[model samples]
Target chain A: MPIRNTDHAWGSINKAFHWILALLIIGMGFLGWYMTWLPNAPGKIKIYALHKSIGLTILALVLLRILWRQFDRRPSELPMPHWQAVAARGVHIALYGVMLLMPLSGWLFNSAGNFPLQWFGLFHVPSLTDGENPALKAIAGITHLILFWVLLVAFVLHAGGALKHHFIDRDSTLRRMLPWGTRAEKSSPPPAMTATHSTPNSSSPTEVKS
Target chain B: MKTVLLFVLASGFCASAGARDWSTDAAASKLGFSGTYQNEKFEGQFKKFDAVISFDAADLSKAKFDVTVDVASVNTANEERDGSLKDKEFFDFAKFPKAHFVTSAFRKAADGSIEADGTLTVRDKSKPVTLKVKFSEAGDKATLDADTKLNRLDFDVGSGDWKDTSIIGADVLVHAHLSLTAKAG
Candidate 1:
């Protein structure tokens, strides 16, 4: 009567954090890309501020996730091949590593730059390094750009894997993460007795034959 | 002895008359100077320049100066950006190749400094600017340091959204150090 290891899925809190953080990271990447080309647009400041705030939020959440994982036990592993399990673990680890690196790199980049970094205009964030050093600034700039590309590729790979399991594997790969459809009993459709036989005219007589 | 005295007086009159002319430099006087300028949140120095000043300090009352600045020779040390600055949007060196400051009024200040109020035309836009010149007498040389504030927008140097201080700052400070050699009038 107990669930097997193959049936194990992520808990509610883990599922929520994973999906929300994924969405935020993807959104931040797109905003960063678009910002480079919009030359002095009116909405540039608003969008840029939102980008900074979201990036900082992601950094905080990633740190918390690290701490949480340290104390909490994750779901039992799926009864897959050894190679598949190893590959899954490796990709998962890489994802978390990049998630932490991307934002921190961006923070350092803005700090080294001569331009001041603002967090939604409410407060001023001081530079991490002096902007006068052109060499340091260039190094930070180049690495920041490279990390962005890596983060983008990694995100696509993560999303693609999830979609593959949902459509091709036809498993509860995505269902386990769906907030409202997790309950076993509630997961199934209701009985189809009278509702299946009812015609369109039952609710509105306009559909009845004259 | 009376004839000798008349000759000395007449020679003194001729020398003073020659000094009154704008061409007089009062014994090969050299003007040496230095200053600072602000661009956006960045402030830099004008490293190298020579102003061939030919105005008499005493005859500054009736003196006029046509000062020329080498447009291609401005060095802010930011070569990439400064290179673009020499282009049409800013300096337009191809059309108006040189920037000029022509003077009409030169007043001696109470603090022994000289203030020259002139029209500096850059990129074809002329604005009245007063450069307060501070000088130190070193033998026959005049060490001159002048400072003045410049509005980039007034000369159409930078305008529109580029004027936003958050992006590229507006107020540009033009500081000058000039070395001039004076010639006899």
Candidate 2:
């Protein structure tokens, strides 16, 4: 099916952002679980440092995606059963909301717990809380755990939906977001590839708006 | 006759002389104690703390001892509270890691308890304080119990004002029990 100008599929750049961020979030979730059983022994410091690094990166990339989404138009929605469309819309919005809240709550949790956040030994991210209050600390701890579960569930639903589209629907819905797929399927390629592939004759003047 | 009188007096003085009061045994003796600090709505014990105490009963006239406690070893179980105590605004473990107390004077009290006056140094602040100490001797071992109250504001522990006292108490109590054995001759 041809990509529509409106109510259409994701363009290459948008698809790239979604896939890359999804991959990073998945890696982060697994890393978080693995770090918990680290025995608080040798190399624990390094593990924690690595976790903080990834957490900060997720914060940055997620923020960047949000800004990009605001400026660039989203691909048109797929035509489907009314209920399926509603479910899809609700889940996508919830996915974005929880995605934003998870990292933010994680930051507050670490800050309140008084863990110095250093980005790869560069510098410390100053603490957000002052003197310790058991009640406040407990609340922050609970919030952190809840957000983690929410993020996990949202991710599974998001991935399962994508996979369902790929296998059951046999449509370009999943292919459109795969990193290796065609321009309409994948997001914009890396700057290096685009620069290398650029040629005066290959330019589609109308496609330059992106 | 005069020589005999001198000998008699010397023997009497020697008879009344007491044994040495303090020992320098680095091992087999330990000082254990508990200290509590409160912040706004959080209060916890400083668990698993040991101090070095050396003193003797016979040398009460000129007794002296030094005490040192590990700051990092404090355990409140709550990570946030423990972490705050380690920060620069509090214990400042990076700069002044260990708190110390050194005895400077001891005076016999009419009530039989001894008033051991000393300087307690915590986080670079040294404050003169007196500990009420009771001692019990048994064979080759001696037990000492001391209790003291400290005003943290005097040491700039918290802010100068008591406004923060709602969370962190203004006064901290330090209690110690030291059991020591006589060193071998």
Specify the poorest-scoring 10-residue window by lDDT in model 1 chain B: B30-39
C-alpha TM-score for every candidate = 0.64, 0.51
lDDT of 1 by residue, A10-49 (tens): 5555656777887898787778899877754335645666
Instruction: Summarize candidate 1's per-residue lDDT along B1-185 as a digit string, tens digits.
Output: 99999999998775555432222232333222212212224444433333445445656665555666667666444444456566666667688777778877889888877898999888889999988866544444555556777777788764454445554455665655544434443
> How does chain B score by TM in each prediction?
0.70, 0.73
Model 1 is docked with a DockQ of 0.06
Candidate 1 has an lDDT of 0.58
Every model's DockQ, to 2 decimals? 0.06, 0.06
Local accuracy of candidate 2 as per-residue lDDT tens digits, A26-129:
88788878988875332554576677777777778778877877766554333334565556666677667766776677666766665556676676665567
Indicate the docking level reached by candidate 2: incorrect
